[model samples]
Target: MQNKLLGVIDATTHKNGIEDLITNRSMSAIPFAGRYRLIDFVLSSMVNSGIESVAVFHGFQNRSLMDHLGSGREWDLNRKRDGLFFFPSPLKEPDSDQLGSFKQFKQNIDYFYRSDSQYALISNCHTVCNMDFESILQRHISTHSDITEIKHDGQSLEMYIIETSLLIDLVQNEETTGYRSIVDVVRDSRNTYKVSEYEYIGYAALINTIEKYYKYSLEIISPQIWKQLFLKDRPIYTKVKDEPPTRYNKGAVVKNSMIANGCVIEGHVENCILFRGVKIGKGTVVRNSVIMQKSQIGENCELDAVILDKDVKIENGVTIKGTETIPHVLRKGTIQGALMNS
Candidate 1:
């Protein structure tokens, strides 16, 4: 059978209660890695996988996403039959309370089911990774799993892991031999067993599962209970990443850093996460900072613990060592020794 249609949910939002302040802006659109945006990872992966159709669910602050992913021309997602689509959040809902991420996803259920495709691939844009979906689809078909959860290494301890076999059984409702709560499956080793399939990489696979069994609103459905019901019995599959993981470029000198794409550095950097399109002049020193997109730092400027917002400019001979414990936030401009957060 032809591979199912693919749907990608940008699911990124500004911190709640701050949406009005940053209207039409999405967290996914936030610039990252030097020159690349965060959504690029997901979009690129989808494009590379030969999945032609993609829909980006924009919640708020989506202008950046719209700007960067314009018409999906760059990734060749602008096809006549299967191309990139932008799904804006519905402005008029009968019940405004259904505004959370889960609810927003639930509202888009029609898009997933209405598609002529047989399978669905769902993912978020918060992570950056290289994935070959052809292999994943092969594994999914061979295993005949209802749901496939992708997991990556280096996740925090707070994350949870579920076995594929157990997940399949739970979703099929074949685990119950007597009266028991769904959580009991986790406790009962005999009924629930582990299978090495794909780890849950915060992404999920649904083989028409949602279209088949979804009844109640996503807001009312408890995630724990849902996991217990479907995931407890369903046979979950795993896909281990055997290839060498990708890392930052070696020519890039990042210190105490969280660096993203589209960056070129030939200077000394310490304690910074430089976003995309950030350029550090040679012979410059940056310490304890968070620099946003397209920002430039002149040579020989010593910056200590500063948070430079997008498009900020720092001129040469500007020594910015502040006494405040909290790093100063520098707006867009050329400055010297400007006290941030003052």
Candidate 2:
């Protein structure tokens, strides 16, 4: 089933609720869990499931997304033959609400026709889970279904498994069928397609909003949930960064925080996740926050329930606080000085 299945990742969805972080990037490129992007979970899962010849369909403002997935080398997908393929759509305004947009798929329909895979696994980019697609494919074949949608806890995870030929037909006759996407074909009962469900009882979270992102980001700090998402066998792959070990200077106090490499810490931190190359100055207290790559916090600042994007610098003596329901988001490359304290 591995070699017979093709992987399709839709990276064009743009969520209004996550606008602060994704204004300059795709939702898939958003940083998560200290060192991984949001797309890492799903992409790595596909690789682990032995699915080669994956294609990513992205939209504009895909610089970071393309950069993160360069040559797909990190995922062992930089093959000479059937490897990673990227398709950049020309549309500016996308149907951000839906998972599988047939219009976007139709733009690059030739790729589907050229591939020799018998089945195609279509997925959205925002879901975080360590799934095994081979198992799903086995079930789809056994049931003789036209389309199989993956569900978790009775809710759709926006993932589907369908035959490559059928998907191509749907894309070609979308106008005549009046079906906008694979989602539409599943929702409307007029079609003769046999839609099946595969219930997945695992750690799955769909992050389309800042609230869900913040909630799930912090929730993975628990050791139990961490183990479920990250397994030694099914490792989640990301762009490898060569950096020195984190440095905790004198008087640095940290508890229950996950800090990545190349970080210099001299502050009192608790319940925080700091990404690579971050710096926490002396006398600062950060609690229940997520600091992304290359961000620095000055001395004597107090941060709680906040998310600092990449390259952000917080000046000394600034205090910022947000409730768990609404996290304070500092955009990418922002420098928050004393004048901008809240």
RMSD of 2: 1.0
Q: Each candidate's lDDT (Cα)?
A: 0.51, 0.93
Give residue 337's lDDT in candidate 1 (0 to 100). Answer: 41
- For 1-342, candidate 2 gives per-residue lDDT tens digits of 543899999998888999999978999999999899999999999999989889998988899999999999999999998899999865778678666788888989989999999999999999999999999899999999999999999999999999999999999998999888899999988889999999999899999999999999999999999999999999999999899999999999999988999999999999999999999999999999999999999999999999999999999999999989999999999999999889
Per residue, candidate 1 scores C-alpha lDDT tens digits across 48-105 of 6666778787765566678777887777777887788877765432221221233344
Q: What lDDT score goes with residue 291 in model 2?
A: 95
